[model samples]
Target: MKKLLHFLFHSEVPDINERYRKVTSAFVVIFIIGYSIGFLQLLHLGPYLGPGLGDNVSFQPLITSLQALHSQNPSLWYALIALLCVTVSFRLLVMLAGYFLFEREEGSAYPIKWIIVFFLCNLFSTLTIPLLLFALATLFWVSGLDFNLGWQWIDHNVRLANQLVVNHVPTLINAPAPIAVLMIAIISGFFHYWFHRLGHTQRILWLLFHRPHHMTPALMQSTTMAVFTALPLFFFIILPYNLIFGACTKLFSSEPLYTEVIIFNCLILIPEIFGHHTALYQIASRNQLIRLASFISGGGVYHYMHHSSEPEHCGRSGAVNLVNIGGGPLFIWDIVFGTYCPLSAKTPRAGLSGQPELHMNPIRLTLAGLAQICNELYRNPSWREKWRIVIGSSSYTPTLSTDFAIKSNKIRQEQATPNPATIKNFTFSAPADAIASVAAKPVTGPQS
Candidate 1:
């Protein structure tokens, strides 16, 4: 017992507790095992305030319509398969190419695990999130708010922009095929730039919806880093782009523009997909043809900077996705907004910083940002301050603690004391010392 105590408390070796490691590993294994079995039926969150709180709130109708939409459209499958070939299958090939082309830098995670993490999280989200949205829409529908019109607002804007282009530059409408595609790209890139920027720059959007994409620890794990993120990234992102763009193209044009579909896909999604892969970006940066095509837009390099873990790359201090906020033709927007960074400026190492918990559990990860918000709200007692925690910046933290004045953070920093809550992880004597130290510390602040 005495030797054990000495080893734990005074041994030069830092990792002295094999039992602790085993315990933690057990927890992790259990977490994964339990969650894996339960994610299908056990993963649901809604039907929230039903029958008693609000009668006849059913998600079945919404769920069924989604199922029908897939079963209903055979063409959707073709489009999906084609998209998968280019994006997902393409990504796997890129990884292999990187393995052969350049020696992977030391410490690069193989990304197989992270890739699986992406797919699993994506599957869970695909099954759950849309239903949640549909249910919310159903509620709004019951409340008599026109949610469909809100989404259609984007379509209306697209039409308005098209009309403006047609009226102002008549030749642009009838331009050669290449020129017409460029126009469509620019217009699409422009609208998407503003919308995409909102996901990153806006407080509510970033914290609740977009931060997980930035939380990815490595991008090379096929650069698909979470678009199951920001439903993270990759297949879901590209598929929708191809699907919606194809549909819209068919809607506008006289015939199917299969060539245009592929072109537009490459242009818009390169940043979202290729940009996240280190080896791919390395290759893309060197290939003049690729460079020339993506020159005017925020391509691989622009997005590489956004996912960079470097403090400056985070753009707004603690927030990320601020640097090189948009892709494709929106490089101009990034520059105008001062969010642009050049690939040549510095070689960026992608993935998240200081947030390993984001990768731990897929289910928790999606709502972790929300959980963090709830934690903050719990800490803050003032309703006004709580409101700010929700609506204000994610980095925002209330400076005050109830009616009492405290200088707790500074005092703890100076004292270098351990938290009482973490005492269970250490020796009994250490915890006693921690308690004494905490008790001895002064709580200084302005008088309330």
Candidate 2:
């Protein structure tokens, strides 16, 4: 027990930052092609959904009406693309100063096939998220809990107290450009921090939505995979933000809120894109603003620590990796909650260390987390244990050892057994290139 506890929280210093070799021309070519495809899709080649709400209660039409925002009503294409471009470009720019992408994968296009699916899923999530949230809004509306109604009642006459707070604190709707952007960052980041933490803390949530992301060993090609969530988790993550956004539309009756929203959605997500890359690369910068921003936002070294699942990085219970949990324009919440792990010399490995299936196949990996939960449910026959499995901390062990899950995963692995029956049984066949997505695939590409 003492050894187990020590293994869980043993924090030894890690190697200093690694410098990756120059990327091959093929990787550059792949990125160019990918970006071109996205640009074309943005320009109407992509499928567009009709506005979700007929009455425009969610400001659905106003967002879809904007050409820059994409065809889907209130789509996040603008923000999504901005994040991709900025993240990749920022690292590329930092290339003039330091290496970020893995040096071993320079000559490889092997991961592209696996990486593209997540990229496309991210696109899918952004476009469909608004529509999904309004469906949730409709559900909440039926429950006598319309956030807009409550907000409207409070803002009915724009009372003196409300006005003072609006003027002083920058309400989501009425604030000027600079203040409004800051407010959006805080609000959106606040939601992201909690939701992200929730996804980690709860076993059900970790399996259902977060596991697919954590399965990727490399963060470089897969950073955009963040938020590749299913419909249920999609509603969970965006509902509160949408509710607040809807209520804010009521705040400014005269000025157009859509324009500000376009700006808000696009600009406020800088911190969201900022942190994950830090998972793999220790960005070197003496620029005080950049340094300070990373420090406050938990973006640079701090957030990189969040990805570490090594026993050395885990907490005393060995159940959670509680380092640098803040993901925001400010990680002040993490500081307040005592979950912040400052970026130090420890270079933690990303991904599950000893998992059977690292979830290389996007098709299988997407729901694999839920499958693990279900396995746990099956292993624990007792109803009380089952209930605890869903709601309990993710690190909570079941009555049965997870060796069953490990063996089941191994049996299902394409390489392990080459099981066609397994492949055909899944909703989608595992793609051929999944094998190449593994970290062991060499830089010259796969030996196979």
Candidate 3:
């Protein structure tokens, strides 16, 4: 038990400052990308919805809700605004906290790199999601099938989901909505824990999407770049339960689901943000929840092990690698596969830089992305190194390990030496034959 506890908490002192910059950068990047996609989607509705109501008719309720904000109660409006702001602000604070305690930079206390990372990843994923959804929606629309968007659909799904949960786990229905949500949350958290563990331990999977994510070992606010995966997993599994719980409350005279859902969702964001950011926040001191969530697999600890930099001691073992150790709330899938890496077991070897190596080659990039997706889905990454000459770089360094420092120093020393034959005088403007003539007649006395 003691050893188990130590393994869970042990972390190499992280460079929080560097991580802060990363987190901030990623946030900004994703934000821009999100808005940009939104803008493009808005453009598509230019002919149909107009500027004021771009695509509004397609999703009236969501649009109406947005439009209603102007006349809504000040408290309600503020709450919604605060909610969105919290998404960004809370995450930034997590990074900032780490920066203050553990990070160091040359001139600034806060690392600007985090800000850049935020924008970069935000742009990439945000744009990607909307475009993806739009493409899918368009495909369906063009197929002559009209999709309905309304509260009724939400209500129906919620009710159905509630029934499913109750049927499978009766204890959930008996508990208070928050308690029920908590139970679901616990299960969903563990699912994340295992998914992440597998993402690391299974090399084939790591090479694809997960590899690009690990591009920066140091924190970049873009750490939240994986939110798409994180949020959807919970939404599909736990959220419907909450929605159903809320619906049942209305039918059975129970508390509103909004309060609990909002609180739980908002709270869940903290770990989501902090877990991915550099380990700067001491929230770990009171991290019972994190420990519980991570212990199961996809939780913070499970993901953290995936983030470790030590060679041999790093990577996942398909068995017991925390992130994707199992396919359950805890780790049932991993147990089935015999790849479960328990927290108490020796730390699994960190997988190869499962991250896709970004290169300028068009074919390589496409292949890399495809490779990553396959790895993530099937857990069979066939990683191959492709060497290319870097024009201006003095040398290429393979993997950012401690040996890189030594290798860099050696490169500098090698560059310092000049060939004896190529001394400055050897390059005189006088003809090449002049050097031969001068050498032949070099015995002349210095005295005039």
Candidate 4:
């Protein structure tokens, strides 16, 4: 038991690099192509296509909601935008202040290239894809295609659950609004924990989606939103989670849950901002209250540790730690499931270990990442190993092992150099006459 406890809290120091390479030409080429196509499709093509392709049957609720918000107060839209900007700016400022004041000396320097890359990635993922999807979904709807695409399974479940709670569960309905909100929060947290954990454990999911987030060589304030994931992940995981939460809110409360949602969003943002600030200094003389909070909620430090690149800190599959410390605002689920790594644990390296220095172009990086995922899906032997664990054919054991890291480093080194036989085959050959002519011409010297 003592040995197990020690292993759980163990931390490894991370590697630091002062100089980062510039973005590659390939990355820039891909980025420009992707950005141009996305811009044209979203701006010029979308409006033209929308009217011709589809009717607004499915989007009526969304239209009605927008109309209601506008009718309630036109200025509310501007106010909401202002609030979003203020919150984001405030969190950024806080992270920068913390870094400069406390962690400047020890922390990795923030690279401007990475900052630019982060913003571009976020813009592409958050804005471009949604607009593109909207246009495409509209076209599909007009063509008599089912836009929901079997999401009714999830919707049906949510509706049934909400109905059961409202009709059969009298005690739940009578519960105070705060209590109901808390219950919803806990349920949301639980779902988020499992979703995050599965993303790490599942090989295909991690490669295609979660790997991009872990590709950053260093962490900064902007890192919180630096996720690069496929569009389907949002629809399948994020959208469903929100739908369930919304259903719960409607079933549990007589009043609108807008204020409650706003509060929860604000609370959640605090930890998220701090969690990505990898350089937040930790004091030795820890406050008892703060320690308790970290233990319960897997605070900023806990998450920072989650970004560690150490093999021992990772799980059996070697992609991420089995003791994954991800949770929503409160990390109650992690604590309950024994996945919570506390502040006392030593911090490990951030980013993917043994990964070559990556090009800073977001679009190219995203494409390359997807390619790598595809290669791993077909070629990596670890898939079978992970499957063994999944099938209960092998007993699960968690230990600090460097075997994977060592092999990864070796593979990276091998990839960096070409084979001698291949190099020999490509050796340039010159005709004797050409060599003689070139030798004869190169004998000229300076007149001076």
Q: Which pairs clash inside model 4? A: 314-321, 315-320, 315-321
* Candidate 2 or 1, higher TM-score: 2
Candidate 2 TM-score, C-alpha based: 0.54
Clashing pairs in 1: 226-229, 226-232, 226-233, 227-231, 227-232, 227-233, 228-231, 228-232, 228-233, 229-232
Worst 10 residues of 2 by lDDT: 45-54
lDDT of every model, 2 decimals: 0.44, 0.43, 0.36, 0.44
Q: What does candidate 2's lDDT look like per residue over 1-448, in tens digits? A: 9997454333222322223112433444455446433332222110111011112233333335455456664456666556546654554444222212444323332244434445554555455556555665676688889855433431322343333333443333566755644554454455556667777766667666765565544454333455445534644433343343323333332233344444433332333333444323443222344445555444554455566555344332232345556544446555545455434344456655333434233333444555556777888889989988789755565675342212252333111111233323222212222211221212232111
The clash numbers for all candidates, in the given order, read 10, 1, 69, 3
Task: Choose 2 or 4, whichever is better by TM-score.
Answer: 4
lDDT of 4 by residue, 1-448 (tens): 9986444323222332434323432343344344322322222111101111111224343334445666787886556445545645555555555434433635434554565666566666667455655665677678888765332433443454545444543333645756655665565556567666655655445544565676665665454344434533544453444344444454455444443343334434444444555555242103343333333343544566566665443222242343434654345665465454334233355666444465555554454434543444445457554353233211121121111222233333102111333223321223332223222322122110
Worst 10 residues of 3 by lDDT: 46-55
Deviation from native of the Cα of residue 76 in model 1, angstroms: 23
What's each prediction's TM-score?
0.52, 0.54, 0.43, 0.55
RMSD of each: 18.0, 16.3, 23.6, 21.2
Stretches off by above 4 angstroms in model 1 are 1-92, 98-103, 107-116, 130-177, 221-259, 266-272, 279-281, 286-289, 312-320, 344-346, 353-359, 399-448
Candidate 4, run of 10 with poorest lDDT: 44-53
Error of 1 at 346 (Å): 5.7
Clashes of 2: 1
